[model samples]
Target: MTLSQPTDAMHRKGTIISVCRIGLHDIPEVLSCGLQDFLEKPSHYFFALLIYPVIGLALFLWASQGNAWHLIYPLLAGFALLGPVAALGLYEISRRRELGLEIEWQHWFSALRSPAFPTIGMLALWLLVLFFAWLLTAEWLYLSLFGSSSAPSGPLALLADVIGTGRGWRLLILGHLIGFCFALTALGTTVVAFPLLLDQHVSLRTAVAVSLLATLKNPLPVLGWGVCVALILILGSLPALAGLIVALPVLGHTTWHLYRRLVRIDGSVAIDPKG
Candidate 1:
């Protein structure tokens, strides 16, 4: 598809990214819309196909180490932080479907060819850095709390330590609070930026500015959206991450619809496209 067709003079000057007001009610609505999109285009094979490499990489990194169980919770929780990057292809699917274009697995590569690809890469890099930072922080916290002791032997032993000890309880409370801060940062930075970059020809600054503004305008709903995503991801992770084969695509599609609801691009302002 022609992702970079030249726009009118107003659009060339840059379109205004308008943030719309929404409510807690919009969260469920967008989720319902996302599920409908998933049902309409059940791309189970598509996501299942893509996830294998990630699983392989994770297995290579942690599977051989018996003591890696301490970081398992952190790794699972950090999935939300990098979700925007993972959902890029799914966004393209939703975008094409929304525009009544024919869908194909080939079209999943559309993000790679977008005019905003470099900027998209930059935003994705930011998320990657955030993900690594989270993992480091989690490791440090674990060391600070229980490093003096030997690492737990397996998932059950680790679970017992966490649920059976005072320091473990402290880790639980602090880890979640710290994790929430990271999640909020990610939500504000990318809640609109990634989809906007995919849907429009805009600079990184403009897309990010609009995303932050949209989150500010609808703080409660956006927060609710983050919470809902975390809950779903947690539940999806329960079945050895097999559930994500469905959960990730559905969430990805829902995010596109949520972005449509949260922002309205208008020909009112001039933004520098190069930024």
Candidate 2:
């Protein structure tokens, strides 16, 4: 089956209804679908994953320059370059399931035919929010450490200043708080929201609410997943972005699975309208 072709009406509706009814227990089936697709059409997934290293290298090299503004251009460029790849990865997964076919590299471009402008616009908005969150967290950490002191003249000096102070515990607490807040706001919506947006023409409010409800319903799994993601992030930072090549792809794939486990689509079950 190909994405360009439609499944039988009965099968299409039935699959969706079953998925909506069984909910998280349907995760194994969903993952099986994704795995079959991935194994059959490895190229698209591989290529999509490849963009991570390219973007990571670009960011690392740019950051090495220590120029604040220089970082922005590469960041924007990386997003522009990688956003489509990430979207393609996601689209292939959805298209594979929709068509009941093994994933194919050909399907990678199918998402480009989706409502491109709105998708890209939403992605851009997401990036902006992420950037601000990072900026705020960094600023808070710096202030907590330096106590509003003047900027240190050199990287080595700055490191020395930060390390010399007995404020490591304080900085850790501040960083943890920032991370917790960011995680709460971001994770609640992240699991299903993006995939929901891509798979269905749903409003952001509905997607976000569904995502949050999913998290709240299965807090342990969600928290474990969060820990896994945080560990990946910490690893990515340690290698000066080299780790992102692995981390990003894993997170992207895992997140797709997370969405499959969480959101309902067949309308077999009714979400509380008040929620």
Candidate 3:
């Protein structure tokens, strides 16, 4: 929250962030458009998304080396909490393509030069904090169920403890329930805020407020989108996190088009930058 008090006056500049209600059908349409965007520039998009697999492998190695095998699932599932931040560059790529600009790999970093970078940084920090909070909550939940001293020897041992006994089922049910709450918070807050800030001159508060309104207005479609994302990330994490090379870009590019459908900017003309 590095935003100063006077920054609130930016809202008085008369920018109107409006939310639109959309049906479930719009989900596939946006995904299709996002696929088209990625296909048009697959090499550039894939190169830009290499960070996801790299991070996944790093996390896997860290968990393995530390014998924190119990954390492997939580750490991987927690990725959804940070997905919006990871996809910032992809949003910029989709934005450039929308404007019919000739794009290069370097353009993925365009979000860094945005007028709203400070605000975007603040939002990204919030997501990071949320991610760590989830990890801690997950650890606490495991400790309460199995005691702090009971560390499993490996992934197999961990799986046996989690799936073989009654407490294991309890952990599974309760863990997923709690994880759902964290995921919902991330979705409701930033599902559209990041892209809106990048695409418009609106204040952070206005952008987040509009994002929440969009979620509330279109709960069914938004929820479906979240479910789809969770499933994709789960599948992508299968091959040593290699699947994200495709999952990340498609989800990232689609998110921009999704934001376009969810929120409409008014009162200020959105400028298309020229090279």
lDDT of 2 at 239: 70
Give the alpha carbon lDDT tens digit for every residue of 1-275 in model 1.
11222221223365655677777878888888888877876763365435733673485368338567888778778867878888887787787777766776667677888878999999999998998999899989989999847688887888899999999999999999998998899999899889988888678887777788787777898999999999898787777776777778888989998988887767644322222
CA lDDT for candidate 1: 0.78
- Could you list the CA RMSD of all candidates, in the order they appear? 6.0, 8.6, 5.6
Better of 2 and 3 by TM-score: 3
User: Clashing residue pairs, candidate 3?
Assistant: none
Q: Can you rank all candidates by lDDT, best first?
A: 3, 1, 2
The deviation in Å at residue 196 for candidate 1 is 0.5
Best by TM-score: 3
- How much lDDT does each candidate structure score? 0.78, 0.53, 0.84
Q: Give lDDT tens digits, candidate 2, residues 1-275.
A: 11111121112323341112123334445445555545554555666667666766676566556533313322432232233236445544654555556555655555555554375457547646765656555665666566565555555655565567667456546655765666656666656666665666455565566667666666766666666666655676467556655555545555676565555456433322211
Pairs of residues at least 3 apart in sequence or in different chains that clash in candidate 2: 37-103
